[model samples]
Target chain A: METELSKRLGIEHAIFGFTPFPAVAAAISRAGGLGVLGAVRYTAPGDLARDLDWMQEHTGGRPYGLDVVMPAGKVEGVTEADVEAMIPEGHRRFVEELLTKHGVPPLPAGEASGWRITGWMEHVARSQLDVAFDYPIKLLANALGSPPADVVGRAHDRGVLVAALAGSAVHARRHAEAGIDIVVAQGYEAGGHTGEIASMVLTPEVVDAVGPLPVLAAGGIGSGEQIAAGLALGAQGVWLGSVWLTTTEADLHSRALTAKLLAAGSGDTVRSRALTGKPARQLRTEWTDAWDDPDGPGTLPMPLQGLLVAEAVSRIQKHGTEPLLGTPVGQIVGRMNSERSVRQVFDELTRGFERAVDRVQRIAGRSAS
Target chain B: METELSKRLGIEHAIFGFTPFPAVAAAISRAGGLGVLGAVRYTAPGDLARDLDWMQEHTGGRPYGLDVVMPAGKVEGVTEADVEAMIPEGHRRFVEELLTKHGVPPLPAGEASGWRITGWMEHVARSQLDVAFDYPIKLLANALGSPPADVVGRAHDRGVLVAALAGSAVHARRHAEAGIDIVVAQGYEAGGHTGEIASMVLTPEVVDAVGPLPVLAAGGIGSGEQIAAGLALGAQGVWLGSVWLTTTEADLHSRALTAKLLAAGSGDTVRSRALTGKPARQLRTEWTDAWDDPDGPGTLPMPLQGLLVAEAVSRIQKHGTEPLLGTPVGQIVGRMNSERSVRQVFDELTRGFERAVDRVQRIAGRSAS
Candidate 1:
């Protein structure tokens, strides 16, 4: 389970765990892998700073990183209200009708819905970055590939390693040319935004495209055997996201959603644009089906879609609608059958990885003899 | 590369090479891997008998197999003209308009379009099987999963091992229960007929589902490293289809198709129902796009779609229409960048598999030390 990535990142294992919960991030770091706290949920700068403070206190001097969902540009001065106004009335009505059809109750009075779009705004993302550098953070990752050149320079100035997720070799080469310290070769089976290429083809292609740069294989990887396969495909390490959703430390916001995830199989997931206005792999729900229907009004673009669906998503989670409850998850959700502690998952991963390596070695040895 | 599959199948390498060409099949058996020739193209029983005779003379005492594309049922008395008449006039006009729009000329008066339907009828497949048993074929495979129980018993009676392709653990379990000797876990990235699950998730699931039954990992496997990864994922061996399309023994019908495959990348392939009325992965071309267009008359069901498109496909190939010419291929086409002999491909796969195994062993060894 150890490789150049582990040595370079000063971790005991070559595993990078991505989570939005600070508790999970701290637990992952405490368990010997780099724990990346997703910053998209922390729309306010102070909220992110508060989480960083908690991570600093709980990580036991272990390294932790932050992930921001910002596009590559110098975004400035656009407020959430401006983006909110861009959503069309027809789209709003379509969401209301669908939610009504599904019998999802509205939120209680004075309970504001979740705000995920603000963090995607360039200025809010920059503000989050400004707060992140104040902590002992070791990595700054851009969810939508490489951040602006100036942003990379700023992270480098603060001794932070810059990484970006690429779905193909073309994007990986671009990230390398943009001076990214690492490339996360996320494949079609990944939870969030992904391209059409699967990991078996993408990993080797990215590894060859970005020669000498560390590549972490992502998507369709849940167990240690898959991790071993990732390494066999020439990746320096592995990055996992959806497997953590069912961990004891994860705050999935609903018990029903957790139950749904546990009962799902690999075939239960589907790639749809309903989640984030881009093609993202998630559990197939009535919500996704409605959006994908031929007669339904099509989904809007990024920030606009997020703005339109924010309240509907909140209502679904709040009410725990059985057929409508889901989160962004990969096909590996099939293997997340039960709840386990983060440390226990790591133990199984290392053991399984070693077993796979030993098995392959024995086979190869016998072949040669 | 030694596994229980290699030992039981009595092959020198744990590899199954699938091709439609008799020459490629003979060469694969000569190279110590099992070559399963696709039998769906042999509509006439006499044609299949001639090829089986050729295979017997050229296999050089090595084992080979045959794959027939017949559904599990008793099919009789249906002629190709009956299936052809079932196609609607609107669909016929669509195909003709599409070819004319592409400037593809009509075939010379006496040239008949290729016939691929008769073999899919169970009676034709049974006749092909009758001719096949006359040769020393060691394996009999059903391309569309397990054939009828009677067919399975018949193969067993002939001392031939029966194998079938499965796209999910549920399907694998069904195949195992039906007395299939081997299960081929074909994944989403596979060429031609495939399931939605990728190999990384499908292989281990099938292996666990059909305990003690051998599973061969297919899809996204083109190189030795992928083969090593497949074995690591708990498969007894690897099943490869697309990589052979560019091999020297492949009769690709036209130089144009060969050049298209050589220049394509992993992202160039798309899974569309434009072919065979089922979702099959193939190189994206204008022909696929025209069928996939929302404005066009939708594709018909199985044998009908095959009937509707056969003439258009022949015209495209005969004219060497650059934008319209394509074939069934997997994402692994990204790696098949050049034409080489089957022996050369096998040599590279073995070396790559060994190197990957050695590399993982070193990492595990260092971690343990």
Candidate 2:
């Protein structure tokens, strides 16, 4: 029952579960799929290292992956000082004002909660990468864009697969050209930063563009039938994000956020840069509303925008206020209501895949008869 | 320099456009945001005539409205006799034989040329109401379940505004409690049949369950600022279909049966059974891969399954020889690359609206700050 992707990742199924929670990632790996932990929310390399070590012990040496945000383009690649200087004072002031208005208390001087825009660029990424290398992670994925060649080469030298997220065929080609091992064709329906492309079209295009390279389809994939559809369209495996956000083990917001997500239909999500300074699909909320307001100051760029609002975002989450806390999810969230274990979700998917295969065969058999 | 939609229909902006030719609809409307046709593809009015007529004249009048098939529930209110009786004996034999051979053709009939599955439905729809009643149609819509009562009563009585299409939100709260002015919230993406809900969360939960009902957001809308992200959430106007098919003015394959719509993006389209008997989506091809496949003869009862493979379907469009012709469309079809003219394709929609607004605003000293 090993899937093509599972063979590549040395797992049983091609299912790759993405989560910010180490427990869920471990659950998926224990259940026979690769669970990849998202490292964006962590403030320090030590935090990521601790989580990876925990996953390693829990999964009993099952293969897993590490995901990092490697932005394709940035304002500057110069020294941290140079990049910080590039940040407009107005933008920084705007961030402060936004937090104050939102009633988020500033962090204590020694808290190290917020970093300036471009503050967490290469330096932080490289540190995290170093920590990840120490772990037994079988795969290393760049969540936002292509990993630097050196990073990919280093991972390859360690026998770790290097994967990158691609929103379009053009992006997929870039990953392939960079000698990446895998390309995750994430459609606009996916959570976090994404492009305006659907899975059906993007999957085949990326598969074609990358030629022999394996592609993992992401975004809006919840059921086995969709996974089957992705496979039919040429993806080797499915990369799921939103579905995990609703799982019983997920570290999701309280009842309010869950209710909103359950009640929402596919159209409820919007691709706004308000959260990540990149077009990421998220649950629409008043916070997003404020940023989208024409009169309100527009969103600042990456890291900086995130930095400015990190504390505010945390407070809102801690409070579990629906209007204040926005969750990053995809259109698939509309279909995610009931709480299930990662294993249960996997079983459903497998069942669905079997059904789809049976269905396709029945159709083909009837035609043949 | 007003758009044809604005000038002819006398609307404020040409921001609303719906059509089977999603590309034409998007191009004309997005260029100036004022082009709408009709979702003639799914309406069961006996072929696509009535729907087409409404789209033609309405968009012809002001570049507005798209009529489509939008079934609310799965195959409800249908009988075995109903399905069996609809297909001519000769056609049934042809379909059975075709199914016995290479599986059902990927498309119903219109994939290549001639009338398609909607052909009969279009004919029935044509007789149900007199589109001519709305002499100068501003917009046209359809409900997968049923057209709104007031929409029928008022539009016919006033000779203005055409409405059709509805799915979910309790069928748009009974078309906004029968006051239906223009409520089309179709999901499933695009193409023939739809459902499976994915209009980015069913177009703002059917605009908060049809408040002040002036919505026209269909499945798979294409473009960056389509109605802007604002309009998409609860749009006053945003309707799209498969934006992949050839336009009336573009050259199409005469033999390749399946319309190359399956290759479309999230912005491409969806599939549903409002057209035939089951919910399915695929490129209209010689083999109706999603429907006629024997493994899942599980097509929901429609005008019964007989309507699923009506004789007219096969004759309407053949594969590998004639692909230019297919039936219906969703907003995703905006991807189709070509152009046409509903009064030169509403030149004003693409150019005139902005210029006219600019002139008026300049005169009023209200230019942007």
Candidate 3:
């Protein structure tokens, strides 16, 4: 099951997991796939330091990646004061009214929850990157855009491979020109901020745009079949995010886990900007529907939107609001109906991919010996 | 190269071509793939009958399919007068103005160019279906929706297999329930009318939705890597549209053919309602730009939009307006950069698919013949 991409990263397979849980990340790395910890919520220097320390101690010295939310384009220097002013009163009122309607209670007074405000600032991301350098990280990935020259330079200096997720071929070229080590072609079916392009069209285009640069296909990739499809499309490997959300080791709340379980099919998720200012795909919840209404108050830009919805989400998560809570996930959430451990999920992926390869080869009238 | 789909269709390969070019369709059928003639333009019974007669006489009695545009939903009986009246005066004026600004000339009076009006009506589609039944057609496919029960029954009576193109898993289920023999999962990157879903997500979902029915992957599929990806995603075959537009057998105007050649990359196409009043992907042109303009008059719905753009398109084609004249094509138009023959395209697809199968099998640590 070793691929060129896995060999380069010193892993058993090219399956890379992007999870918010360090335990899941460590498990993936330990099982011989590149486990990438979602570092957006870990923007605090102290918080990130402790998390990375835990990952290092738990993963038996295996290599892992960290995904930071460093958007390539954003307004600079807008603080909490500015973000509050930018958000319309109607939008703020709408969030408050909906949370109250959904029976989500207010947080205790004099105790500001860490999840109440957004950590989406580029400065915050830079701080997280600063923390990542202290650890023995093998890969540094940016979800929304190409890393800045300083970040790229510093990572290269530290001998850490840089990867950037792209929704189209043009963006992939930008990553390549920025001296990135890998181009992750993320398609529309992906959970986070995604472009209108799909993986089948985007993967090969990115590969063609940045030849010789390793490409890990993201979006709608959960099983071996999709992995085979990505590889056949010239992608070096597959980077998965949503499939890990429902796994046993995922640190999702009970409400979020329940929502993921009841997803009717792949068609259940909607790509909306409600959760994070950017159009990140997630399960259709009341919170999303209220914000996504075309005639209703529109959303603010990234950090501002994040700031506006953060408290509401924490309330919903804390109260275990039935239909008002959801997690950032991809269209692949439909297939993640049952709960399984990290080891079981990894084994399923590898086994399915092996079976798919064998099936195609047998169809080609070839023998697998 | 033989697949269960091709074996059932009695073809050498599981590749299907959807084109209006009789030469191209006949050639694809002659070369061991299903060649489907686009019958939306053949509203007149006499015209459709003649085309089928010509096809039967030309292809050495080889089997070919007819693709009729029968949308699942439409107005019952709207006459030409009702359609004309429903179109706003400003929208009509915008069409006339855009065509005149592009230097397209009007047709001579009484010449009655065949391309003056759209044949997207249910009545028109029914007439085309009537003609399809009269021929020895092997397959009957509906582009916009599932075939009517009566139409399905009639096709079955004639031993013709029925297929429908779906943009989602839900649509695939409807088609299967309607007694469709096959389902074609068309993705966003496909030319003509498409849905928001991409092939990677849509293909597997549709395959899962319609258990036993054959599924053909379409949209953004022009290469062998894509073909292999389709097969891996569980499609029995691949349906190609835009790739054939650039082939030598395509009877495209000299100007349109040249425009197809200059398409820089896959990013050159846009999915807009300007062409058929539906969100179909096509090469970007001034004609599309004017209709896509938000400040200008908005597009009319369905048959009305088709009625409005029909004459404008004919004038552009006749005048050979390079920048204004464009063809219905997918994002794969970027890869359709060169002028290739039908045989070459088919040969390349098969060879590429075989090599991809071998490559994946080897990566899986399996033996390939």
Candidate 4:
């Protein structure tokens, strides 16, 4: 039960549960694993503070973490204004037109207007970081890239561990170089922005490459056996995301989308830039299909495309019943049909791990017998 | 332009490919594709001859295929006869001793003799159906699983096409149900026995779940446009086995397993059962650490485990360059340092296909302004 990662996170299990909702985070910590709240969707500082406060109260002093976005490489040399300027009138028109073509209605004028790319994204993300620091978050994670030095230093100052997601070993080294406490070797099979490496190869490679820095295997890992495999391959622990997305407490957008995810097999997802402007795996949907169309305007760079389409995403959640509007998830989402409580999910993983161990033992016994 | 697959077998594109190797039959012709030969390691007399002849002579004079297994897959499933029956007593004692001390190898061996499990493998695989079939071979492919049924049938019936190999999509369906003229949906990154499922989501989804089949799209797909995304996902062409495995009409093995693949990118290869019994993708190496570890046992079923350990495989090819022991391939194999000729490995496929008509039109005449 005492894993290297558990020692690092100062928790009983290295199970770092991520969720955008506070209730789920608190629940996971209550279930004995650390629940990390995602700050990506929090628009206001006060909103994050309130959520963290609630999580702290509910978790009963059990430790937890916080996740923020800090993209390593963005369109360089372009100021926020410049990025906004680069958003072509035609491109904006095209997105609007495409939405219309797809039966999505235009946003009412002046409803959340003047949303500039990069400008608001960085501001909102940093603000959430400030809010996160205000609480007793045990770990601070950057989902997109390495944390800014200030963020890392501030978290360390607050006695919080720092974790960063790395899509490749080179990225892993960058995080190590930046003095990160933990590195998440996320393969393409993971939800959200991920690279094209599988867990089997990436975990050990990252662990070896990082030279002792604790590496948590992410992507396509839902079962206890997969977690055990990660540990077998040198990962200190396994970081799960999609598995949480299908949990009973997850505040998923639609019942239909949830149903689709539950019904899907591991093979049904894809890594496409249509959602986040980076290759993040998710259930293939009509929205992604449009961007994938050979003849359509290719996906624009991050923030810009994301900004242009945020309202559409909001609307899709509001009304879209199609598979295309589902949020990011990993290939493992395929095996995530049944709804289980976060506690039940952990129990199932533990059972699966035991089964894997028993199976391997049996296989070895055959040669002896 | 008239290669064996084209001149003798007569298919629009002489290329043939499929997965689980067993389903090459309908996979090829269904899409007006050719099912190449597969299962060099396991070919029964009737299965091999029927597959080759059926594909070659059946495609209405259209070129079809042939694929021969040349030892690949990892986890050499070899044991001396005495060892096979009772673990040689010596090996058994060693294993038991190790288990008693270490609480069992990290992964135990299966409850069966590795040899016995694969006892019938070689007899069925090395049959060399190509020698018996009188039809001209348009293409040949090999990997895990048995070759497709119709691959031999259609080849002999029409004197036209043939095909083989596949990694995922119910391996059985690609040949049995999809009616693949030729089938293979190798991972985006795989060396052998693949099922890593990248090819941007296992091209063809095993060719639309095996219908109007005639797939090739093997692992990594090694080029821009890759026959224009294998005819934009409904692959009429695209077959690659470790683009890096050295190529020389004479030194195919030597040239294939060099250090070039070792230093390849994250996109390089995946671990899968195509090579060993278990799904595995790794750079080829003398240590062949993948299969040797008692912890993982790493091998899976069929010709893969046999192919990986076969004496003829690179272990003996170049004076035991352990690195060169297993098969090396996939889209990532494009890094293979040296190149060879089947007209330089069918110039149209290796290089020409990038600038082929369909590709040109995809990027043609876009307004730069």
Q: In every candidate, how many clashes are there?
A: 0, 112, 2, 125
**Tens-digit lDDT string for candidate 1 (B1-369):** 678778777898889999999999999999999999999888888988888889989989999999998687554677778888899999999898888888999888999776456667788888998889888788898888677898889889988998899988988988898898999999888998888888888888898899799889999999998998898898888999999999999998899999999999999998988878988999999989988989989888887898788878888988999999999999999989999999999999999998888767766654221
lDDT ranking from best candidate downward: 1, 3, 2, 4
Candidate 3 global lDDT: 0.82
Q: How do all the candidates rank in terms of DockQ, highest first? A: 1, 3, 2, 4
Best by TM-score: 1
Top DockQ model? 1
* TM agreement with the true structure for every prediction: 0.97, 0.59, 0.92, 0.60
The better-scoring model by TM-score among 2 and 3 is 3
TM-score of chain A of 4: 0.91
Scored by Cα lDDT, where does model 4 land? 0.58
Q: Residue A257 lDDT in model 1?
A: 97
Off by over 4 Å in 1: A74-77, A366-369, B74-77, B366-369
Which of 2 and 4 is ahead in DockQ? 2
Model 1: per-residue lDDT, tens digit, A245-321?
99999998899999999999999998988978988999999999988888889888886788789889989999999
Tell me how many residue pairs clash in candidate 3.
Answer: 2
Q: Which candidate is the best by lDDT?
A: 1
TM-score order of candidates, best first? 1, 3, 4, 2
* lDDT, model 4, position B59: 48
Query: Which is the winner by TM-score between candidate 1 and candidate 4?
Result: 1
